[model samples]
Target: MSKSQQHDHSPLHIFLIFLRMGLTSFGGPIAHLAYFRAEFVDGRKWLSERSYADLMALCQFLPGPASSQVGIALGLSRGGYAGALAAWAGFTLPSALVLILFARGLSSLGESVSAGALQGLKVVAVAVVAQAVWSMARTLCPDAPRITLMLLTTAGALLLPGMWTQIGLIAIAGVIGARLLTPVQAINHAPLNVPITRRTGVLWLMLFFTLLVGLPILTHLLPWTTLALVDAFYRAGSLVFGGGHVVLPLLQAEVVPTGWVDNQVFVAGYGAAQAMPGPLFTFAAFLGASLQGHPSGFIGGLICLLAIFAPAFLLVFGALPFWSAVQGNRRMQAALSGINACVAGLLLAALYQPVWTSAIFGLKDVALALLAFTALMYWKLSPWLVVVASAFIGWLVL
Candidate 1:
């Protein structure tokens, strides 16, 4: 897979392609997958059909943003570590830059326009998140235990919005998965050792965790502004489970409370993020561009990018090394199973609280939400088109 010697693509061309994907790739993980399949698997022939599918599966199995991970992997295939970085840049740069520009515009817009836009944006968020819940439920909730877990996860998230609470749920599921989902070989082996790659990934996890905990504490005493922000995003990117919407909850915890971005503004940025293409992680671009102290904008976007994706890259490079050997392990499978079930719950929970409750404020709103959902589910419309129609409808309804 080495690209150092002979390759059809130069590093720059590969980088540019990813950048375009970042700039224009929208729709949630599934949509992102379709886009990737079209461009890389069908159009570019950058990845063979089988290889592309394998990469998508690997990303789906891991935590963090799956689509971003896929694009990064595609980048790595092109030129190793450098290629990966290039891909990250390509995928994120457009959104980051565009968001920054948007933030600047928002800063200047009169209150009347801003207020109306913000209100409309929140409604859009509600609709978008609702769609996520319904789509994921079908894909992830095939069994009863999983369906129950999804329900529980949603309830727990609503009842307790604490950071540790979220992490605790994910951890608890991991244990259940280990027991219930252990593979046949792992069962036969009796006890399996952690692969060196997983160990490397764990080390990165711990190292990053240390920075996350320590940097903020250190910054109060010293002058390490960037480190704290970097650590925040690095941690956010690394630890988050479901992509896009999941990160929204985490980012809300880290930033909004601190007055980083006002609640409505964040919602608006999210509304705007959906309008673009690429991974939903580009919402990080908006946070970076708009945050006070200006860190949330350009500089903040960089931190968010690294924070959100760094762990993913490490895990991909690290664990994927051992994934081939461990794929059939029931325990590994179980863990993913449990995690995925919870993931379904997480989305469902999200769908109810912020999405359904807040978005469906009135009868008209509910009708619109249902209409949009039906279009997506049955008519199989493009998300972008739905979003555009929804935005106008939101404006009209308001």
Candidate 2:
């Protein structure tokens, strides 16, 4: 098929396609990738398997939600920058809306969802995160050295337990990896036909860093709550590596300690997010709507939803033009390797503190969590089904 005929190349069409998936794609990031490949590669023939794999690899290397970045990249390839936005909107909005409503219900009705059901959600979060840790550890920390790095990262994160500490550990891990580790040689893939020029790509990169560095300073000096909100969520989005699950730790660090969101609520919302279909980053919408003070509704949800995702948009667009050159850099790959290990470590730490300590209060809670984990890990049941069943169990027993 001709290039024009192979892809619709219409922003609206792209939005509608992703919107459908946003509603129906129940599995997490890994599953989202499979869905994307089936639709865009096998069904639509928008790109060849090699090109799609290349895109996925590039997104995996960059820091942010991988599946969302892939969607944005695909949109950019087919529909330009506008298409990227449409793709993100289509894929992101459904879950964001659901989470926002969930948050609103919690805020307005306080006990609309029973404490047991909410606790069940929190218990399920433990299983979800444990699965993430297990899966990522196998992939990112295979060798002894990388495993040591992950263990040390977990130790440092637990001892220090803050956003800055997590950042410091990631940086330190990268340095260690760059100095000590040797990455496998990179493979070459067919060039992606993205519309962005390298010069424009450079400009986007500059803007990404500018906002990354400048936003904190701006928020510090100005004391505008909204800007602070932006700074927090943007930083969370900017630094999240590994996968959507990693965002759990980064976000809990950003929102929970600051009194912006309650810890219990945060964990509950995370559980709810797992049940939702789309990017788990839409958990930002829940945190936003659950904010303690001003801007704690749809408006807050919009602001935070945009802020957290903005980095992904900028990074994916900016990096696409330069991916070919950077993808093969040995040191860069090594650094990403270290960062991924540290990310798994961070999640490990989080699974202990907020997710485990809060939810697994009694032996019954422990039993429910184990059951949920078994259902997720072995039975291969749908996550939403597990979530609903866990909620019912929590209501019935815990």
Q: Tell me how many residue pairs clash in candidate 1.
A: 22
For each candidate, give its TM-score against the true structure: 0.58, 0.64
Model 1 stretches astray by more than 4 angstroms:
1-87, 102-106, 109-132, 177-312, 319-325
Worst 10 residues of 1 by lDDT: 183-192
Off by over 4 Å in 2: 1-7, 106-190, 324-398
lDDT of 2 by residue, 240-299 (tens): 776677788878888888899999999888877876778999999999999999999999
Q: For residues 3-92, could you state the per-residue lDDT of candidate 1 as single tens digits?
A: 654454466877777766665454456546655665665456575543453455456556788878887777766666677778878877
| RMSD to true structure for each model, in Å | 7.7, 7.4
**Best-matching candidate per TM-score:** 2
